[model samples]
Target: MAEEPLLMNFSLGNDAILVQPKFKGGRWRERRGLRKATGPTGVNTDSILERHSKRQKTGNSDGPTRSIDYQRRTGLRHGVISSLFSYNPKIQSVTDRAEQESTTLPSNAPLVDGIDTFTSLGLSPIIASHLLTKLDIKAPTAIQKTTISRLLSGDTDALIQAETGSGKTLAYLLPIVQRIVQISEQKSKNGNDTNYQIHRDSGLFAIILAPTRELSKQISVVLDSLLGCARWIVSGTVIGGEKRKSEKARLRKGLNILVATPGRLVDHLEHTEVLDVSNVRWLVLDEGDRLMELGFEDDIKKILDKLEQKKGKSGAISDLPSKRTTILCSATMKTNVHKLGEISLKDAIHIQAEADAQQLLQEPTTSTDPIFSAPAQLQQSYIVAPAKQRLVTLYAILKRSFSHKGSVMKAMIFFTCADSVNFHYEVFARKVGQQNTSQLSDSTPELPTQCHSSVLSSVNNPDIMLYKLYGNLTQQMRTATLKAFSRNPNPSILLCTDVASRGLDLPSMDLVIEYDPAFSAEEHLHRIGRTARAGRDGRAIVFLLPGPEELYIPTLKHGFKDKRVNGSLSEDILRKAFAPAIASQTRETWEDNATGWQLEIERWLQSDSKIADLARKAYVSHVRAYSTHVVPERHIFNVKELHLGHLAKAFALRDQPSNMGRGGKGDEGKQDTGKHKGRNRDRSRNPAASDIDNARNSAPDPKEAARQMRKALNAMNPASEFNIA
Candidate 1:
């Protein structure tokens, strides 16, 4: 019987060749004619086929046998070949890692056995009982234990510096509240003086100045909660974004404990006649470092001068402390913080919670420039990703974090500017199909009605909810957004700028993601401080680019006191993020889906002109904000070393960096029409018009001109009007 002819097909580059062998006279013979190649391009199929034909002619081996040998040697089998085309390194999914538990008390929690309870720290029994039963605060934090007694004395000004989330708020708050309550009780006991009885009409006795509006609101909330036991004393907040009329109404109604931002407080002091500062005794500057950084120095100086000039001018109202005790609270001690202390404090006692009370008292200046640390119970990690992979990597981190529906109930992602926050929030919302595409206004005054629905869903997680907050949003919107995110019990994510980075205590915040690094190490500390607060166990991770940004790791290690900061591979994160997709399809297919999804974002930018403009504005603002890093840390965050094109890709931008910020195709013809006509008229009038035009052209590139304009606008108002929603 004659053997059937055997045909073998081999692919070389973009071409393929067919070889047929025929059995004749009990021997196999090769067919010389080649079939058309149809494989990957760029490979030389002719030379490979020629070499195989020559080998066969020399009687070295049969064509099929040599091809089999070559296939085995080069791992060119179908499975192996397919794998080569879809090469992805395997890594352990983040889901497989064991959940970490808090082994140590929070840094703010009392480390020693002495003076653990609030009552032991000089708080009245009523206040202590209220704290324990109503607020569930069983004990005093280290800062509270050390500073409470001194602040309660009401004679010495104190500079309270402690790690973030270490109870600095209560360190000053409790003492002032305790004194007010005591004075009120004393007046009530004296039946002869009903006029001195503390009520809403009582003079404003305490002023708590916070750096951010959210923090001021938070402080007011905490004070209100504490005052549940003492209902007569009212606490109110005056922040920047709220209507001044309402704030004035509250001021006129009287607030025994007033919480305010410095700028707003100064404005009230200058404009409002009802704001009485003559009887003010307690001045608490919260987040002092941030207060100085936000250029509130002039406002704070003016406030101090006004307080001093009007202090006790109306005399004591109810036997409250006669002296005005200034308490300055900060996490880090910088030169500006010290200058702020000089402006607000007098004969100040330096107090820090990180050290022992005796040691701190003995060497008050030892921690003058101490490094700030996150909560001890916090698990801090970082991932170094390339610019192109940044967005997907972040998506993966969030996916892995919320993989288990109830495991991570809340997560916060911090960006550099409001524009970035707006851009990213919209991207994620649109990706999950939660965003309303029909909404034309990016600056929606209210969150979508769907956001209020408790049963929210996401593509990656079934119960995920998305919220965003930034400075550009209206004050009412910011307040409502924060309140909703805080109250939502389901798993949620908040995309925000540093507006949420100060002393605002978010509830059940299990994870904090620094999608963009802070300008300073101290600011980074504050960003991660959002989670793992008040002795609660939490996790934080930051994204760093692969170039000079990696150098920031050492700086972080130094700032965090060389804490165990672990590094995560972006590949691992990506793999884990796409695990759900991979489980449903082949690895290659799932990878393609992810790639296609990213491309879809690029396409979306191209199709939606409004979103495209927002994206460009966001990218420009991000690069500008990146360049404003603190001088000492500029080496690691140098903007000159950044790959603008790659970074633009992270924003789903396909345009060239040089062409960014310029008007789109539709606007190209319309731009500078009047100016061009003037130039043409000049050209027609004088021969030197060309030279003049040359000089004008040599002034600056469009990108540079746009950058200067943005800088000027930002200098005038730090929050960009273009950054909405």
Candidate 2:
């Protein structure tokens, strides 16, 4: 056999020394001869040996040169194999045990055999048939059953408190719609004239106020569907994002039901002359706690005052009640909610679903505080992950869920801010081989007409769809995005902020991942409430950082008042997250591939300036938002204890922590005053280059980003003081 040559390279200061090894008998031996070290072309090499001799004297030698080659070739493989197999074995064992022992609290209000159906609860036969045939609502939920009869009586104002997704919307809506229909029928019958019929000009009988435009639109949709059985009645929505002219036109035509957001409703009450409230009989504040949390107390107070001043002085309209009935619905009875009830409700009956039938019909009282709880059927859990592993762990969970053919078809991942949502959506969309739609023309035919412009599907896996929703999106886009997400039949994921947390009922939401914890425990309840809706079996998992964040587990448990809420350190989920790489033949290969995946993300961020800027903004905004946790929970989410570098890794950033400026506020102000003018000139001179310039200039100031975070936090906890500095 021919002799094999082995070469080894060593560095001494800036010089490179090459050595050859020879095998004598069966063992390897280093050659006695040494060639002079070479310096960077035409540099001196005499000092290399002197430095090596000094290292040998100091006993700081580089070990045997012959063994160096052998170790270099095999050391990495051994280390990686060992590490991969032993990754958090103790934690894995505990997680496995917990997984086996996991259990949920018995449903508080179990389904009763003799519960009243929609028809039995005083709904007309026509409405009941429409609900069953069109809406597929087979039965009234617990809250619906308890509150429908009370609302139908219209004897007093109502305060409906129930777990999220327990049919609070319908609890108030069904009664109002039924009353409107009943009044119209009675008027026609009493007058004994066909012209006595009620139409759109009959005046608005019900006003539904929601916190967000999306929720307002959703409420309008449900109201529209319920109105199908009585086409004579009309419904309309006036939210922040749509045209005021269109809303004015709708108001001019008259509507029996008006669903609106508080701000926009207040605007119309002050400006639009056609929006008459004199005949309004039913007022609903859906997601009442959320309305207060969003700082709508003033707007709501204005609305109530205006309605009272303009309320009809005449007697009952046909069979309808004389006084206006106000219904306030909320999942949590926080101090603000209680205060809101005091303001809007009068002689109100408090209704809640309870295990004890006797206690379910109690009147409103201020002495006893109500404990907020999630749905009993919801399977809630948490994962304690390091800051660096957050992104990968999320990826693992999504991958595992999507890998199954039909297990999880729809999922939601909630983030802290719009930037975070945008950042993650782009990262995952690009990873799945989809192009950035923002770079394309507005009229791109590649996107389906039914889908939003921001919605993207994986080229490799057509079944996987990604959607993004946040406050920054135009109202039309937000509405379109939500419509597409709710109707999508394939596996889809929505990355969103807290805007989607209240009163919006998304169908078949199998999973919810709280990538960022809510500002308060109540908010957390609302976030998880997105799943496990209407007695459906659903799952929710929240990610907590390894340190103080882990303490949040108990807080959540206490909030839910359920001992079954547990923290998991599941290796199986982590394995599944990295399954694409783990499918390889060897552990070493898979480990490398897994590591390479993260590196690939980091490289991608570096390649695109716009994406890199977004990642930094997301990281900073997340940290700022983390600081805005409610005062009681601040101990668990202490921002100073966070590892900025490690957190940056989750955003696929490779920069040092110190390099991440506080939102580039100083830099933004230092730019020339005519920078925008220069950009406009460039736009007219070269449109394509100006597009890139515009994108570069669009990165927001860090101070402004932090201010927005503080604003949102302030809205959630208006009493708390926030100092972002």
- What overall lDDT goes with each candidate model? 0.67, 0.66
| Clash pairs, model 1 backbone | 13-40, 14-39, 14-40, 14-41, 16-37, 16-38
lDDT for model 2: 0.66
RMSD of each: 12.6, 11.4
Model 1 alpha-carbon miss at residue 163, Å: 0.7
lDDT top scorer:
1
Model 1 alpha-carbon miss at residue 464, Å:
1.2
lDDT score at residue 124, model 1, on the 0-100 scale: 83
Local lDDT at 137 for model 2: 78
Name the lDDT value of residue 285 in candidate 2.
93
Per-prediction TM-score: 0.76, 0.77
Give the candidate number with the greatest TM-score.
2
Tens-digit lDDT track of model 2 for 430-466: 6433556345332332342222222233333356777
